[model samples]
Target chain A: MALLIAVAADDSLREQNVGQSLQERVPGAATVDIHGLYRAHWRYLVRLAVLLVDDTPSAEDVVQDAFIALHRRSGSLRDPDAALAYLRASVVNLSRSVLRRRQVARKHLKVAEPQTVAPADDSVLVRDEHRATLVAVRALPRHQREVLVLRYWSGLSEREIAQTLGISNGAVKSAASRGIATLHRVLGGAPDA
Target chain B: MRDGMGPDDIERQLRDSFDARARAGVPDGAMPPPPRFATAGAAPRRHGRWLAPLAAAAVVLAVVGTVLGLQSGSGHHGQQPVAGPSGRQTSPPVLQTSATAAPVDIRMVPVDGATYGVGMPVVAYFSQRFSSAKPLVAATSVTVSGKPVHAAWYFEKSAKPGYPVEGHLRMRDYWPAHVDVHVTVAANAITPATTVNFHTGARTIAVVEDAKHQMVVTSDDKSLGVFPVSLGTDSTPTGRGTKVIMAKQPSICLSGPGFHGCGIKYAQQLTFSGEYLIAAPWNAALGLRDTSNGCTNLTSADAEYLYRHLRVGDVVKYPDTTGPMMQVAGGLGDWNVPWAVWLKGGLIPTG
Candidate 1:
């Protein structure tokens, strides 16, 4: 019991020091050190947004908006400890908006015929195959795609995924299974284990 | 089954096919996750009838492409997202000219500004009209030594049609120290073609210790005053290091993500560092929050001063504050108090 307490105390001290050190480097940054905070997590945020938006540029925009929001609300972040949580929430919210925008655009924006097309050849065949897979993935319901991206690409633990997305563990698993099943149907039976 | 494939076999094939498609730049719609799949709901796409066969074909072709190992040497060339003239905000990559046109009288107007956070606008005003409706400029396909760059255009609707058109460029994050932007506008068009030389100056000339931590300025030089400002919490540290000043905007809309701001055409920003060109709000409730995406949260006035004076290539650095030993090295890293002292004293010691 003593050892456990000692270890816990040490970890707590380390964390406190990290916070303090950050605060010292960027005084008053305990809560509002958006720069340092972004350095650590922006890549992950961008990566996450990329999956959500499925477009690098749009994902970047989404993440940028999230950071801007953090800056705007820096004062209101009551617990310095929960800054990451706030950021995650903000990013998810922003991504949702992007999705909404895309849906809206799709509904109204009547695009013309594709101006460019791949030339016919073996490469074209491969391109078509890739295009097919993309279409299939896009076909999956938004929830399924989200579940798959978080679980597989983002490599989040089920629990973490649950917390970030605000869902039960059971829901995450079910979503994953269903998504996988649909993907399976699309790919013409599993090729490997 | 068409080929007597089992469910497990099908699932694996699908996953592989999907992943393969992603690698091909086919826009597999896959993103890195910590997914909000639940709250956001499952993949909301309504697959049309034609999707299945196309996907199957895609899988077959991808497998063949893999085996042939003929990596298409050609990179993915995505079509510009076409937006209409009036309602569309996204700017297609500006057209570039390789051939130099007859030397038309070109006026150089350098406007500098900064942002409070990422994706904020950086606008610039031209005193006179652009000479070209389609002035010839060097290619827009330029990248700084370190980071890739992106540009967005916002026309000054209020400006006279023939006069100088106000232009705004929102630079990305973590840019190299030196970035040169080339833009050319037709003599008659409202938008003007302008060339800018952006430099991310060296970091830290002074240290202002405040309630949170230290703020470092790059040089005693008055031409450009680049300060090192901390962003949000360390766990979510905003992008740091040096970037070059690009365009300048008088005002911008901060309607997206973590923060919001407007009417900020202060502080000339680095070309491509972390995507914060906006200024952070001075709300004490935010804990003197260094909560920007690597943008220095300047008082609007200070931002204005920097905006007017600072040129590009002014380096911005945030020395690691674990200790006080500070040193001015090219790369972004930690600095101690001694280093801070040395910097403050104007001693340029090699890191």
Candidate 2:
């Protein structure tokens, strides 16, 4: 069988190991990817991770790890487009790990972290009224948020989401549906917890 | 997909929101410092935060992600995993069958039919909430005098005492300068048809970039002039959004925690929180610094000029500030809310 690419290759996903290094430690890679793909793919990947991780710095860290993983494995990887896919999958998985541990820690330690009160700078991008929806999205159970963001934000297919999250296609579809339903229920005027 | 509302609208909103956040992620030209991976050979310096979390994350993520088959699924039972577009649950169109219920009534805001600024939003305050906003959205129509525009009704639950919900009419962008706005609501089982017409006087936008401590004013999209100004102090930061000048006064008393002065002139209300743009001769050194209690302080002459030209509903935008984001429900901030999210309706959709 031909090398089965689980997720379809997007231009960003296909953005080959940009320059000599795509690692977070490589400052030179910033200059190489700065013009086009940096804005498009790099920033996009970071933003995707941001929604998943709920902070810009953490999102950056997630993207860095994904890129490092991609750079390390690009030698054996014949197809370059798969690099982006590989990076994307890494981000999703890494973010999931971060959130799960955080959730588990919070539950165990009972750490009342200031979870959803978006910092003033975070509000700079999203307006006050729209903050509620983003907050609502953030409030969803972990897996549900991931599915909705991947499906809607990334426009990933069910197969793509399944492969990325390492879940069944049926699980992706179920999570997407439940996520949307949860969004509607939460946003559709249920002024309560 | 349930008449395109099953998951399409919500999906579109999520896409739009995600894209907006992505675009607004880092300030322009402030890309993340390049990753130090190639040289570091070692894992990027691990903060105890990520290092600790990654351990548990790795162990759990290593499960080949059996799709949560291990945990009992009864926790979220009542909210039976709803099938999105990918699954079986189609959103049944909300059916309204009560014939005896009173027809929903809507009235146009600024019923006096006066001229307003380009930033003005056409509001139709409804008497009560309706199960479906379909009728209200369909009944309401806005016709611009000069340019052909595609304006839509964004319905949201209004928090006013009497009116429970409202459908605000706005183009994806601002109205053209010196154009008439004619809003016609067709009387239906839901709302009585009524027409109200108002005019947009000028295209004025005041952008306050806090770093510069100056406001660049524009008329009809052309730079009118740059005026030195003083904005909110550290404690009282001004709202940061494209907010409309909701109301204006020639002179007004200024009062706050420790400051009290009457006859503070050229006051324009920016937010319901009492943030204003006013003439402050008291600030001996205006425009050179940030020291107002949240009001944008301009020289009396400049404030007078603004008062003369800028009418109610003109825009005063703070492009960069560490301040609160304005809510349209609180003031004339409908323009600031992204059109996509606005289309999702509001924080609280119409009941």
Candidate 3:
């Protein structure tokens, strides 16, 4: 009973202090336990999500949903370190699910909505070669695209990509290699030897 | 010379042009997440001690649950499930195996084709059509020259939750050398078990279909065709960004990226300068249509044909798709830059 009572007091104080500190920093932060997590990872998460979803607003939503999930599963994560991986995995899974659903939905809308396949307005004035290069990177597989974005755009290490994507490092390497080769093929270039 | 025009002069212009393109597509109100998480630094230290125990627990749980399920359904069966520590009720177990009293049908596939790369995924679909229910396959042992192989088995297209053995396979190693890799599955002795023999040569790889009609492509030689591809599940599917085909080879090769839970070698590869690879496993039918992370997709047959015809200097392009489209002769000629430090130009956006 004494140990139980002691444990209860400790839990309450820890919860209270964490809650109070977070609330002081951001209004309504009390509603979200992952405020710290969000503060730490929101930028990178948004970047990764945007690379997948393209739209900024949707990327933000994806990150926010991931944070919410983290908050709900805070108790299940006995170790704080797993929190980031768990969050990244959640975001990727959710994004993939959304994409699959969108593909199915696109079928219904394809007839009614004229398929307008135009390069972004910005690409118009860009030099033909530059446009070609950007287009080439865009052509890689979804997984490879994310890896390249995370590696180059985000500048994260391979370990980070594997963790974020919930795949083996081997898988990450495989995706990266295949993606780059595909880019070289499409862009008609050769790798630096 | 004042403008620094050289062999890569066109590339400099292209880089600037692409930089502007990135700026133009920059959507409003989209903020970049921080580069990494705070928890990352301390994760390894904390979990290092618990990994073994966690793995054992997982294996035990998997074995017990699967064995029980099999006994109730069929009296004579050999069941093997990768178990962990959560007793009988925990999360899903990764690998499961079972031998049927009656002959179980087994099929084999080869990782070959024009778009073959080191990490390309080659799937084998096996089935024994019965009058009563959906066809079932019994794959007892699968290997490349006697080396045990772990594969995800499913009766459906999508990798669903429970099919005993269904998930990604890490076979970067153990591939047969220039010969047929045999796969055998024991049945209850009803239907003839199947065998899959794969051969990857320096120039082309062959995908041998089983009695049933299933296609698997693999190749060590870089002589494959261009396949339309799309990014997998990442934020920037492969074909969305700037890319170029940087290399060509006639064989498969895998490299390690030095991360945890990943020690397997890779597959046939095509490197996109400053981007990722397009492995074989994910080559076909995964929400991609002429778009990929940064690679191209080609049908095995098309790839084989292209492999024979296309040269190293051939160009590719992506008009309105995620990656680029092949413009072997001219479309991308204006952008090829060999003597540039573009990777370090800081023009490439930070993810």
| Candidate 3: chain B TM-score against the reference chain B | 0.26
lDDT of 1 by residue, B1-351 (tens): 255345554444344443432222222111111112211323312211101110100000000001011112112122111111122123222222223321212333222121122212233322222233222122222234434455333223211111123333333333333233333333322222434333333331333333354444444433334333444344334443333332334454322122234454453433212233444445332325555433446655555665544433233343442222222111111121132333222211112
| Regions more than 4 Å wrong, model 1 | A1-32, A78-81, A111-133, A190-193, B1-351
Q: What is the TM-score of chain B alone in each candidate?
A: 0.31, 0.68, 0.26
Q: Candidates 1 and 2: which is better by TM-score?
A: 2
Label model 3 with its docking quality class.
Answer: incorrect
Error of 3 at B116 (Å): 61
Task: Give the per-residue Cα lDDT of candidate 3 at B238.
Answer: 32
What candidate 3 gets wrong by more than 4 Å, as runs, is: A1-33, A78-81, A112-131, A189-193, B1-351
Q: Per-prediction TM-score, please?
A: 0.33, 0.46, 0.30
- Give the whole-model CA lDDT for all candidates, comma-separated: 0.37, 0.58, 0.35
Order the numbered candidates by lDDT, best leading: 2, 1, 3
Candidate 2's residue-wise lDDT over B255-305, tens digit each? 443344668888776764557889887787576788887889899899888
Q: Which of candidates 2 and 3 is the stronger one according to TM-score?
A: 2
Looking at model 1, residue B253 earns an lDDT score of 34
Model 1 TM-score on a 0 to 1 scale:
0.33
Interface RMSD of 2: 22.6
